[model samples]
Target: MKQQLVFATNNPHKVAEIQQQLGDRYAFLSLQDIGCTAEIPETGRTLEENARLKARYVVDHHGRDCFSEDTGLEVYALEGAPGVDTAHYAGPQRNAKENNDKLLSALGDRKDRLACFRTVICLVQNGQEYFFEGKCDGRIATYPTGDGGFGYDPVFIPDEGNGRSFSQMSTEEKIAISHRSRAMVQLEAHLKKQSDVARPTA
Candidate 1:
């Protein structure tokens, strides 16, 4: 049987992306799979804090090894105005289109479009916690483009990409160089190390 690790998120997109990135080594469970209905509090002041909060919640309540992550789009010109508030930038509605519109409006007539996507993952296992971080430096597009990704994907263009927004790329293409994928690479490395240590020597 594959080992089970709960992911402290109900978002299918996030769970799917992570599972795809990490592969079939371990079975991944989402908050819904564990019967967790209460909205996990994310009142943390930073990405690391929010990720820790969610991971801790699963560890304390579900009594399982799990991980959680918080991602934000930081615009250099805006001085990171929407760092922690990336999801609810426009309002409590959490509307993606509105959020993108607001971001564009906020940068009206500004030449600088430099930005970056950052992800912080907190893994809690056997009462121990670890953090992994990843960043994708890029710039915001003058207008939203493509329709492939979710959230700010339509507007955020990765520097590594070929002059295209995240939404312009397929899932495989986006995950290849995404901030989340970068963080997951570090996490997978740690998990492998733990697995090796626990292996029985022949």
Candidate 2:
């Protein structure tokens, strides 16, 4: 039987991305599917802290093995202004277009557009917590392009993507090189190890 895990999120885009990356290794469910309607608070100072907060909330309230991730776009020029507040950089409204415009405006005519996408994943299982992290180096685009991805995908171009924004790439292409994909790879490996250890030695 496939292992069951709860992903502490309601974003269908995120759920689809993760499901594609993880394949058939585990069965995944979102908080809404499990009847969790309350907004899970993300009141941490960093990505790891926020991930832990969400994962812990799901485990505590739902009593299930759960995992959560927090992603950020850190721009060297902006002094990481949106590191922990990437989702609400523009305001509490969490408008993606506004946030993108704000970032581009803040950049102005600066030649250096160095930035990185970072993701922190926290898994809570059987009262234990595990964390995984991944980073993808890239530069912010002056204008948003493509419509295939969510969040900063339209304006963030990964170094390995051959100058194409994440939104321009197919889901498979993005999954192969995204920060979240890298973190999920590590988490999968850890879970596989744990499963092996728990198996009976016949």
State each model's CA lDDT, in order.
0.93, 0.93
Q: How far off is model 2, as Cα RMSD?
A: 0.9
Model 2 per-residue lDDT at 182: 96
Write down the lDDT that model 2 would get. Answer: 0.93
* lDDT (10s digit) by residue, model 2, range 1-202: 8788899999999889988998888889999998999988989999999999999998888888899999999999999978999999999898989999999999988999999999999999888999999999999998999989998899999999999999999999999999999999999999999999999999
Per-prediction CA RMSD (Å):
0.9, 0.9
Clashes of each: 0, 0
Off by over 4 Å in 1: none
Q: What's the TM-score of each model vs. the native?
A: 0.97, 0.97
Per-residue CA lDDT of model 1 for 1-202, tens digit only, reads 7878888988888888888887888899889999999888889999999999999998898888899999999999999979999989999888999999999999997999999999999999888999999999999998999978899999999999999999999999999999999999999999989999999999
**Alpha carbon lDDT of residue 104, candidate 2?**
92
lDDT of 1 at 78: 99
